[model samples]
Target: MTDWWLWMYVAAMAGGVALFTRWRADPRGVPLSEYRVAIAIPFWSGLWYLVMALGGGRAEVAGHTVYWARYADWVVTAPLLLVALMLTGTHSLPGRRWRLMTALVGANVVMILSGLVADLTTDGTARYTLYAIGVLALLVVYGLVWGPLRAHARRQPAGIAAVYTEAALLLSVLWAGYPVFWILGPSGVGLLGSTTTSVLLVGLSILSKVGWSIVDLGRLRALSDRGHLTVV
Candidate 1:
């Protein structure tokens, strides 16, 4: 009956489709681990949102009807996403040390957690402080991706490199939007209505979680079809 319900419907469908496509399709040549982790984010995210959607929708925290479920989804899915990137990166850059990948994953979780704290906190100064920390941690994640991950992707074949590069860029842009929406809030910027904001937030989750998952996995499937994938 509401926009959020529709948004969740689309997200749930998209996430389910992504996983089904992954499970049903033959690997061709894509690394088994890459396929698994790439599919994992949306799989978990879909379940998270499905449960939230069924459980009376938006949640309240400190008098604000915040989308805490989305943040909780990010807590698990964000790190899983980075792991997929790292696994995909290994196709060309074989020496993708586990430590750097793990560090990025850890930093992303911290970024999400700090932002959650910022959102939950009632104190303006403390909120801003947490937001700043989250932003800094997020920047570190970008630095890791662009600096090391980019280098690794570049070393990969032209096609795999392209896919990895686009994935990295797509993730950076999409993931960055979360904080912008969080900062805007219901009383924020005055650019969007509360209902509209909720719609856009759900829309964003669908895009980042469902859309990205399907598209990136599609790329892998394409690579596999072309026999470009390595048996990692």
Candidate 2:
């Protein structure tokens, strides 16, 4: 990735920040947990994107064309994304502690980082082993989302429940595609060429990160309008 191709990633990341900037706070000063988490989601994500945008995309690891900058971006932003999901439920599921949210966030980070490690591993056996571990972690992630999280959302108001359910679904589907991007790249399965991988990964990142942020923003605004969200 060089020149315009490389700059494309920068543009995508920077544009993501721009999209989320509009919602960094409740313009109306409503004090909702969703507003807080919603604001934070993009701020950290945009920060990581900026970091990745500045850093090196290529690394000399296993000749896999490692984009460690992307890994760095995920390591930090992934947890914030999970926490954003939990915040959607703050008012609906008020009695819960952060244990579940924290655990889920940790699991999510482990899942992606492990996959990155696997992709970077030169040894085939070790790579597959790490990949399996990452897959297991993702299963656990979905189990939590569809299990307790889904249950709680169901008990929320109809609007909140709808938003949470759709948000969870969007998040789960998009996040799951990361490994596929890994596989398509020169890194993992080598199903695609380097340029192709970069393009697809860029598109995927935009949809997952920017798309995820937008879904939550619309949801939060809806809650605010319905008087379900609290005032900040």
Candidate 3:
């Protein structure tokens, strides 16, 4: 069952690469930067899932088997995902976005790093403390995305704004599940068994990475077709 979910993740990512490549071949008006960042998300994710599937990327942390590679995957891909969303939101306006982008990326990194440390810590107090910190970091990420980022995106043309809304909503909701799963899974309170946790995480990864990219790119392509795409 674990192999099934692991390979499923690999296959989903491979499919994302192919789908994006086909769309990128003739990008119409979508920026190459977007395509590159979009492609990198799934590419990195697929590689890490491949690593996990090959019987590596696991560590015995706090008496639980932690897939550290998943955190490694998040450290890389999560930033890239935010970058993609940042590009989408600021497709026409880039000048004032760097600050928000920095906050988003910084908070995201802290979230992933803290989660990793929490996983590795054996002390219950330390582990939960780090988990709280990670949760706070995630809240910061959410505030940036929904507050400042969404506000900026709304200033875009209607098409671009709509795309940003859909993409941002999709990403935000999917990401909220990660911490819940973490706290419930073997890593936290062990309310969820490892197998169930792995399956759930695999499902979330597929949506947040592969599924979200497809929606983002597809909507952007539509905007391009409608002459809403700007060279940013």
Candidate 4:
């Protein structure tokens, strides 16, 4: 695999770990646990898209791979990871986590349908436009729904909401940039810009994971000490 593919794999694994850690720490039990699993869906899907984009090469699929087309899917799919992360954290949809999940599923379905149509129709401009629409849909969902929910949740202590919200917002910004780059730039420039943006996002993801891990460790230590003191 290319260096880009390797980096993508690393980013996915790191994000998965960060997400799992937060899920485990969630004291609310099943509501949050289910949310965690929901969050994993997009992370895993995005990872698959990343691998296909970077490593699938010119392999034929149904007579034509549409290599660049698959990358457009990757761009659309990547934002879902942030959305999932936002939902899993304290920023759950007020009385509507399931509703948000449904919306996410619907958004993904539209994206897939549009992608297939674009692929079969072999309309490059339409494909790009459809992918751009998908990206916009995700942004609106995150900003209007998930972001507000998270902001409300952050009123509590433990800093979980704040950390996760910051991470998700950072990721959302990165994901949103890809389509903007494609829409505004010259040929080949989008690829360069997208790849550069991915690199930065991946780097920030690693740091975010590290921070979360550290915080989790501190909490674990405090709990352990509390238990020991009680025994003493």
RMSD of each: 2.5, 2.7, 1.2, 7.4
What's model 1's TM-score?
A: 0.87
Q: Model 2: per-residue lDDT, tens digit, 17-110?
A: 6655555544433344544554554455555545545664557777646777777777767777777776664545657647788779888888
Give the total clashing residue pairs for model 1: 0
lDDT of each: 0.74, 0.70, 0.91, 0.47
**Residue-by-residue lDDT tens digits, candidate 1, 1-232:** 3446645655675555567465547766766676666666667776666766675445565556666676778898888788877766667554558888788988998899998877777777888889889989999999999898788778878888888888888988998887787677652344665566667667777777667766676787788788887665
User: Where does model 4 exceed 4 Å of error?
Assistant: 1-96, 108-121, 146-148, 151-155, 181-232
Residue 222, candidate 4: how far off, in angstroms?
10
lDDT of 3: 0.91
TM-score of every model versus the real structure: 0.87, 0.85, 0.96, 0.50
Candidate 1 vs candidate 4, lDDT winner? 1
Lowest lDDT sum, 10 consecutive residues, model 3, at 92-101
Residue 86 accuracy (lDDT) in model 4: 39
Arrange candidates by TM-score, descending.
Answer: 3, 1, 2, 4
- How does candidate 3 fare on TM-score? 0.96
Decide which is better by lDDT, 1 or 3: 3
In model 3, the runs with Cα more than 4 Å from the true position are 94-96
